[model samples]
Target: MAIMVRSWERLLLASIHDVSPRFESEVDSLRDLLSPHVGYRIAMLVVPNHWGNAPIVAGSPFASRLRDWADAGSEIFLHGFYHRDQARHQTRSARLKSRFMTGGEGEFLGLSLEEASVRIAEGRKVIEDITGRAVAGFIAPAWLYGPGALEALEEAQFALAEDHFRVWSPATRRKLASGPVITWASRTRARLASSLLAAGALRHAPLQTLRVGVHPPDVRHPLLIRSIEATFNHAARNRRAARYADLLD
Candidate 1:
């Protein structure tokens, strides 16, 4: 007798990170593509505090637009206090230089517990000040957090923390989900190929929760844009959009 395997219904959640002026156009494009699919429960990461010397403020017009979207019911996560790595001794390879957040590395990864806690508190304040709403979660820069970082988040009272491919609960220090992540690639062809590959992989896996990550630059590439749209369309056909908050409850 042959046995049949049953597939579970998967939850789809899309996320975007690394917001900046240079990528405004691409961000806008992404917003447009995602607006119609708003029911999918997308999330944006906002950077408000950091150690880098960059003068860009989080309250700029571009950020305001993103905030507006969040106000309209989309989820928003505090990306990093500064998005940049500022510890003087740390060195990033050339390939990673342009990719780091603008200000330099902020105070999370290498700071002492006391220092990290202060930064986390300050960062949450900045985000709340700008958005006029309480932030539900935090995501460390580069998804890199020191051993002390998690404790800092808990003290600051953030309900959740999102890593590169996982959603964690600071309170329980347990992972809620680590789904497939679809992030942007620097090369256009590479982005499309990765998206295509990810789509196929999703089809083969037992349905669960799927999380996709997008950088603003990904939307600028026509091929990548199409691939993202196609991916979302495909997922919608197979599963319903699930909220990250819902999983905790």
Candidate 2:
């Protein structure tokens, strides 16, 4: 019998939202954990506009460190214009309902094509300016995007778009790879459960690409951090680590 070995290129993508207190430490730990690997690359997703305020890019303490990471060859991606709900609903509950409906497309689905294009373009500019580097991709807030969002991405000239399950080409409009994704839930128990499930899957299947999604809050969990390190080591042994931009090449 052939020995089953999980083979997948590991790519870590982290989403950083409203300047949280834990942001600095989490970033430090992540950098320390992944820096030693020869080919490891991370995509740091930045939420430019949250709560419809001025772009929060400049005010973040970790912004400088993010730039350093990019300088070291990590890819930076624009997460979303705002990481919050911006819909026509009147009530708070209604607004929440609208935000995530249809995976967040509903919130911006009503936007005119021109309006959507404008928003995406503006966000792209802000992120690039802050990082002083070209952003390689766009991932919508909550990994939620409408069909129209793809068109907006193309107009803005983003090279990649990462959704909930797969990484897609904005130019070709097709999935490049699909396999296990490591994402955290709100609770510690849920986060642990998901990491265990992901690790188990990685051990069994022919996973071509391992996409690990992390949020700032998840760094607090010891198990989550351990799982991340273990996953990286596993990938280093079996597959090359790459950034989303590598798919283009």
Candidate 3:
């Protein structure tokens, strides 16, 4: 008797995080690299205001590009208003995660529900104003959010939200996918460690939905760039490339 194995259905979502005018050039380069493989299916996690400094305005070059991407089927997600942590420390664990895990990019961590709601609304408005389209979703910086962040996301009416491990609908509370993302770290040692971890995932995490998060800094490192490409190529063998919207569909 001949036996057949059914391959697991898997989804692959790629995203460029911390996108803002500050990293526009790097973001473009990464997009160029990704387009050939995934077309315009990648998502852009945009910072409406970067570090409470540079704000993305309507009719600007960046905003124009965002519209182009959105029209081309790339999703625009409202990342944190300021992709920098400014909330007061609420706990030792939160403080440690901010300082070490996120490198101070977890803007939502430790924020009160009201404060998080206000920021989420503000950021979403800026993106909607520029794109003239409703922002597709929201993803907190570094995939870290405060206790009230989820509540605020629901109140703000975002269709979707993502953490490090899963994507879920804020309104319906339906879990769309379960998978750990493969992403690069910043420093040299950390980058090397991430490369190994990502390689391990490629080798072992088959038959599961996978998310690959690409940051501007990852494009700067040659090794990390290779790792990102390799991961994509490996996933392409069996998994279908997808946008966040595809998951919801």
TM-scores for every candidate against the unseen true structure: 0.76, 0.74, 0.92
Q: Which regions of candidate 3 are displaced past 4 Å?
A: 1-8
lDDT of 2 by residue, 1-249 (tens): 112323343443333333322355765566566567633366677666554654455656555666666687767777666655455544565456454343343334344557667777887787677678788788776665555676787777676887667888886776766764666554546546865676656644556766766666557777767776676666667666566766664
lDDT of 2 at 190: 54
Q: After superposition, how far is residue 225 of candidate 2 from its true place, in Å?
A: 1.7
* C-alpha-based local distance difference test score of model 2: 0.61
Clashes of each: 10, 0, 0
TM-score computed on alpha carbons, candidate 3: 0.92
Tell me the tens digit of each residue's lDDT in model 3 across 1-249: 111222465777889998899999999999987887788788999999899787888889888988888878788999899988887887999999998777778999888999998888888888888778888899999999878998898887677899988889897889877767777786668656866676667535854678888888877778777777788888888777777776665
* Candidate with maximal TM-score: 3
Residue clash pairs of candidate 2:
none
Which stretch of 10 consecutive residues in model 2 shows the poorest summed lDDT? 1-10
Checking candidate 3 for backbone clashes, the offending pairs are: none
Best by lDDT: 3
lDDT of 1 by residue, 130-206 (tens): 67787768877666676577778877767778765688888777777775465546544654676567765654455
Which model, 1 or 2, shows the larger TM-score? Answer: 1
